[model samples]
Target: MTQCHEDRVTGALSVTGNAGGLFHLRDGAVIAVESAGSPGVETLLLSSGGISAEDWDAALVESVGTGSLQAALVARGSIGLAEVEAVAVAALQDGAFAVAAGDVQECVVVSDSADVPLLPVTGGVAPALLLAETAGRLDAIASLPVPLSPYRDRVVPGRATKSMSGERREIVAHATGRRSARDIAFATGRSLHSVTVEISRMLGEELLEIAPPATAFSFSHWGLPSLRPRAPGQSSGKEMDWTTTPWPPNCGRSERTSPE
Candidate 1:
């Protein structure tokens, strides 16, 4: 009996009898196995997810392009419990010494028929190595920088106050006032289209003022309305100081007695 071992990074693996072919392990999963061409050798597809042993059989037929290997291996159904135990026992009885699955660590080696364990070590790394590899991949993904926008630098106090998404806020907060859209997109991991869309939305809301092209500054000054004063005695209209000797410009003074 010939033994083979393989390691996987992300997807699953499947083995059809000695004839080599491709097989779907699961959604976004795939397995490739090479057999020793030994007669009476059986191909096994073990799955832990919703896929059943019958699904593996169909997948193998669709992928391997031949039913010769399918006829040799016995397909069995086992749920959440240890599916490996049943697969191993069946493989040993078929006078075979090699087995393959999507996960090597999950495979149980019950017999010592070959130099290595009776089970062919194929698919993802050993249980211990798998943990370390997964940690490293997660660290890389987490370390990736977040996306940002370039227009952030030109935000004037009152003008840029429109409600912005968190990503947009980060970009605006980091703006150095000199970066272009392309430059900002590169630095922030955001596409130019997304940055432009947010800027256009802010402009439409009057939160951002567009300055004329070719100007050193691209945005206009922010304007905030002032509060109106109330009348002194009535406490509602424009207030006037009657006690004072005179009033400033635009002041009207008239005294009219009302007839009862």
Candidate 2:
């Protein structure tokens, strides 16, 4: 696969209108497009076959007829099913074309041009396809009205901030072992930037320790000793020897006995 760095600010893939090209995101994630195409005119999404990135690109170009739907994929890399769903919902709300693919669900196609939903595959579609579809839908729907009015003005809304913090905590709790930044981001509902920033802050403050590969930190390995109480009246110099005295009435005890 031909790998090249895209702009970090936009998180977009830089590619010419050609076949067999790869785009690397700012988070060190790489996506190889099977071919180059426009956004809304052609099939924007292509399934990434279990092959080399170069082969994947060539297959996509051959399948889609031309390079009309490649820009969208370059903009957005492969996304999860949940993220695809979110994009689809947003796209449908705005009266635009949207597509979705899931591990268990078939490929979904929703568009203003089509009356019925289209399913390319029966069983499931790959993540790369889903991401491409989402990007295409987003591009098609960009002109429509999005229901982001309430969130458009806030620096960081209260609910969003709280949710982010909770997600971070959950990520940290489950980050017992050495996991990649991308994996943590995928697990914790956070972005790659957010995960990296939080990890850096934690490491600098000595609150978290990083282990390479599969190493993990266990709670039981902290080496703190357990505490236990001493027996009553075990000292000889103590004056309070009331163990023989009668217990309080109705104190759930019929009699009292010494330690012997």
Candidate 3:
């Protein structure tokens, strides 16, 4: 990444390993990043109610294969460019954290012809700034009494409790011995970094525990309900009912340490 920044390259860096990511750089500055271990910008926007399902579908249609869904959304006034940019930034930071938290075996540079990000940070962000923040998040997680990998360890509810509320409560509600922190993030429409860190702290509180190897889980999306996030330009053919999203009523567009 440092080398790419120095060279002022505008292209995509495809990283492959335990967890992988695609970093989009424009003029040497990172505009966006995508990682399977973390929710994408599309998920963030839809899950946060920053845009509606119909709005996303319309944008996808308008952009077609142009890879300019961001422009389409803005053109229609369905959402502001700044709002989408905020979500893109959140996705970028969390994507970086997800890739770093795992093992990275290789990163190959692809030409600028690679499809543009559905949404990108306007003016972009310095790679150094992103790396610094990701490092800080990792350091905070390392400081936990029991640092846990969001993707590797399946967790189950611990010490029965009824008082948990907000995100933590939702997390516990989904810790059914069949899911990892990553799964919970997908189910809750939250950033993987936040979910992983919260789960690590909860382990210390005895509110969660590692699932035994012998634990039998259905594995069908773990038989747990999902937030059913729809990727941009990819539709389910059926409109999603998103009125019951689990986001806290107070959740807003502010940039969180690990925005979801």
Candidate 4:
């Protein structure tokens, strides 16, 4: 979240890393965040069985039909309002985490006269809150033994558990000595913090063993969805598909009292 001085970015802040991303902040609050590594809200919902793929597609259609995805899903009884909020929050945190790991480049700003791209917005998350949650995740993972950072560390099945089932068992089973903690989180549709905390404990109990780290989620390997540019005649307020948009779309703009 470092910027020139304590100033918020005027446009898109491009970050380069294993998962390069664009962070858009307005009035110091993030509106839309796209990350090359983080899973989309749709992926989380479908993965967690919050909604089936078919239901997700139906929701999309419903969104276009109703002009609001949030309303369509809830109105159709596809998911509760709270679940939608949870998905947005998780996507925001994961996206922020990826951006934080990267070296932020100079941000690109749009001219006042130019039309800003109307990209889909997940939710507005305060940058400070995102950073705080990320720091908490780091500290939780830091409590573990050597070479575990949750994002990169891979774990393998060590000793069998006492037939326990929960986050701990889920993590140990997937620890395949290959998948990173992020991977486990996606597979289980749980938050990274919850997964990593269990991982630390499992490691302590010898239920999981650290594997020689493999190339975790890297920028090159991270799959970003394809974004179709809006037609030239498209209105800026028209809805855009949130999933297909790449990271670094128009994030947010601040109402600066004074120009930088």
Candidate 5:
């Protein structure tokens, strides 16, 4: 992501799945972002009392055929400059993380002419900077030890959070296995990143357990066997010793010598 954006590369990166993201970049900077897991900035603004739904609609009306909705909001004194910038940056970060949550193998990048209409950017961010911040956020979550490390893996409270209090306890109490971190954030008025990190920590502390994410359709899921870890003392899965390993039931070893 940093490389694509840093070289001022023009294109879009699409994570090829339901929980994926589409990021449009221009000349090494992120211009527009959309994510499946995270809601738009408007949701956060309304939830945080930063803006009202009616006012947002009015701003949309004001910007009809004009310019950026964010710009219109600022111009109309609907929100301050700093707040608008903050919201935009946060939303972008959220989208980036949401895309990242997908398995890295599933993500694919393609370059092309920048002709597609992108969501009007509230602000642009350098890809390197955006990626760095997102990595740090994920790191905060990953520092905690847990059985499941995948982002889309849901979690449920496994043990009582009786020993915890405040936000931590509140978060664990609400882990019903049906909600993703983003959903919990909306329900609890917490930031998505914070909730993700917190859930990771609680899981490490044995206050939570892993659950499968909502099932989705994919040939990989149904037909493809997932990668498994190498057996004990094995150097690598690719270097399997088929000769010494158990046979596929009654298969005989080859008696023929190597062909001269």
Candidate 6:
């Protein structure tokens, strides 16, 4: 990114790794970015009711030839210029966060503008400013007691506590040991960064815990056996019956706990 800014280039930075994304730049300034691991502009717009599905589809059809959905939406009055810009900017920043949080192996500059698909959202943001903000977020996550990967690390509700409310409460409600932070973000229509950071705090608070992956169990010749691990500090020489890990005390409260 520094090299692109230095050269004052125009095009997209194609990145490939654990989670791939595209950074669309114009004159070395980032105009837009799209991360596959996070929700994009369309999802944000439609999910947040910024634009109706019918209207969005209409604008998409109208923009088929021009490849400019922004222009099409503005012309059709489906969305105002200010609103589109705001949503686009939010999506761009969230996309940048998603890419940074993942494992990126390589990034190459694609000099051809035709190869870039994302449209310009804001006037443009300097690569340095964007990188600085992204780094700050990553650093904050790293400083947490339990750093998390938005795309991995399924979480389950831990000890019951009345302290959680609002968005944090909603996050706990969705943390059913099935969805990762990314999946929770998509399910809740929130940013992946927000969900990840909240989960990290909850983990630190002992309100959430990393869930073990669910796998099939094989029955021994005698009968089905427990799948729980031996108690900590127990010597390997000791022979005992392993019991099932108990659920959190509040897991069965009178609430709809089915995961989405």
Per-prediction TM-score: 0.22, 0.25, 0.78, 0.64, 0.64, 0.74
Clashing pairs in 5: 5-28, 8-27, 8-28
Who is ahead in TM-score, 1 or 3? Answer: 3
lDDT of 5 by residue, 113-139 (tens): 454422345446888788888888677
Model 1 misplaced regions, further than 4 Å: 1-163, 211-260
Question: Where does model 5 exceed 4 Å of error?
Answer: 6-11, 76-78, 104-123, 147-151, 161-174, 186-190, 204-207, 211-260
lDDT of 2 by residue, 66-156 (tens): 4322332332355344443333233222111111110112212111222212211122223344456556644433333321111011111
Task: Write candidate 1's Cα lDDT for 1-260 as tens digits.
Answer: 11222332233233443222222121221222222211111234332233455755564565455433332222423332234444433332221112221112332222322222223223312433433443553344234343223333243212546677777675565444444443344455443334444554554565444433333254442332223332455332333444343334222333333322
Question: 1-260 in candidate 3: lDDT tens per residue?
Answer: 98889999899888998679988999889998889889998888888987888988988998986668889988878688788888889999999998998889998988664567777888888999999999999898888789787788989888856567688989988988778888899889899988998998889888889998756254322232234544443433232244344343322222334323
Best by lDDT: 3
The superposed Cα distance between candidate 5 and the true structure at residue 259, in angstroms, equals 66
Worst 10 residues of 2 by lDDT: 147-156
Candidate order, TM-score descending = 3, 6, 5, 4, 2, 1
Alpha-carbon runs more than 4 Å astray in model 3? 65-67, 75-78, 216-260
Taking all chains together, the TM-score of candidate 1 against the true structure is: 0.22
* lDDT of candidate 4 at residue 1, scale 0 to 100: 51
- Candidate 1 lDDT (Cα, 0 to 1): 0.35
Worst 10 residues of 3 by lDDT: 250-259
Q: Give the alpha-carbon lDDT of every model.
A: 0.35, 0.31, 0.82, 0.61, 0.66, 0.79
Off by over 4 Å in 6: 161-166, 215-260
Tell me the tens digit of each residue's lDDT in model 6 across 1-260: 98998888899898897667899988888888888777888888887787889988888898888888889888877678999898888888888989999999998899885865444775678999999998998898888778887888998888857686778888888888878898888878778787888899888888888887761122234222334443654423222234333432212123333442
lDDT of 2 at 172: 60
